[model samples]
Target: MQSSCRKTIAELGPPKHPVVSARSAGRTRDRSPSPMRGYLIPSPLPTRRTRTFSATVRASEGPIYKGVCKCFCRSKGHGFISPADGGPDIFVHISDIEGEYVPVAGDEVTYKVCTIPPKNEKLQAVEVVITHLAPGTKHETWSGHVISS
Candidate 1:
């Protein structure tokens, strides 16, 4: 039986492989044009380029921001301010308004962002003061009507 199996094997041919012939060897290599070639890719002339984060935020500083008084009422003595830089609206109380300015809607204002403590509440804008009337806004002049930040 072993002799018959060997005779049958001898009649069969060897298996095909990539390295068997020059024609097959050509098929194994990539022939497409590469995008990296023949183009003037800019290299850093001075410093070698490094992996870096491009969208880092500014360093933390005193949270003073320019905003406008959204609403204010002498009776309620509380309102919210819309920040000019598009942050969340901050709560402001009449007591926070220092100097002689009375904040009103559309009044250009400056305030400091403060975090609420203890029981936990929304962030508040403290040291609220009217910076100036918004463009085209008019108000009767009181002494120190506009408070500078």
Candidate 2:
């Protein structure tokens, strides 16, 4: 483009003007934490809690499944077992238990499969025998058996 100002450089050289910038305003960046700037420094989240799980077996039934008795009421005489065989919890009735052994929650038992033989049926445990009682069970002693919770 042709210069609109036909005057020579010597005539236009010195003019009244000063450049303004952050540096001129004393706000230049220095790569250091700024005291004036507000930052959302998130505090470390509260220490996360950990979870634990019981040693459960794969669900199946044939050659004696090992499981934990989820719970049983002496009066109700029935409870569920989470089998180590990786199968869903199977129902265990008092009739299935052998000998004088009565189990409580957390008690370990070994048992074989027994089908109810009806529609909407699920596999159940029969011929159950208490292999071990978990420590701290309510059943401390029964029929001279020192059972653990």
Candidate 3:
């Protein structure tokens, strides 16, 4: 009876589970539950598109008036040149400048004029590339290759 059972089992071949094969190879068994019952489906998120512009750096006199850059918004015929920085002034927006990266404080940038006087204070940056980056004041040193022990 046992011999017949053994022959029947051999004829049936392997089981349809990865764990069974892994155990036959002297490996530890994994018993984690799977998410095949519609429990772990992932969903996509929404995204937004941003517009770009350009400008040029302009000089100013006030304490916060480090300088200004000119940028255009719609047409070239009309545009406004606003102060880039004013001491204690806090009305600068990221959309006002045009460039691959945002301009850091003390960075020299050029942009296009977007709004002119008697109309609006905002300027649409057509091109906003940094002309001069503030120099690094700190110094660093690195040691040469280490000797084998």
The weakest ten consecutive residues by lDDT in model 1 span 40-49
Per-residue alpha-carbon lDDT of candidate 3 for residues 45-95, written as tens digits (9 for 90 to 100): 100122212112331111222333232212112222344554222223344
The TM-score-based order of candidates, best leading, equals 2, 1, 3
Candidate 2 lDDT, tens digit per residue, 1-149? 33464453344444644876665575544544322122111112111111011101222324777888866545545566789867777766665676566677777888876554332245657667788767765563436556445
Error of 1 at 88 (Å): 1.7
- Model 3 residue 142 CA deviation (Å) reads 28
Off by over 4 Å in 3: 1-92, 96-99, 116-126, 137-149
Candidate 1 on 9-97: residue-level lDDT in tens? 12443455545675675455543433222221111211111212221111123556899887665554466688999986666655567
> How far is 116's C-alpha from truth in model 3 (Å)?
7.9
Candidate 1 residue pairs in backbone clash: none
Question: Best candidate per lDDT, number?
Answer: 2
Off by over 4 Å in 1: 1-61, 119-121, 135-149
Clash counts per candidate, in order, are: 0, 15, 28
For each of the candidates, the C-alpha root-mean-square deviation to the true structure, in angstroms, is: 30.1, 29.8, 24.2
Q: Candidates' lDDT values, in order?
A: 0.54, 0.55, 0.32
Count residue pairs with overlapping backbones in model 2.
Answer: 15
TM-score of 3: 0.26
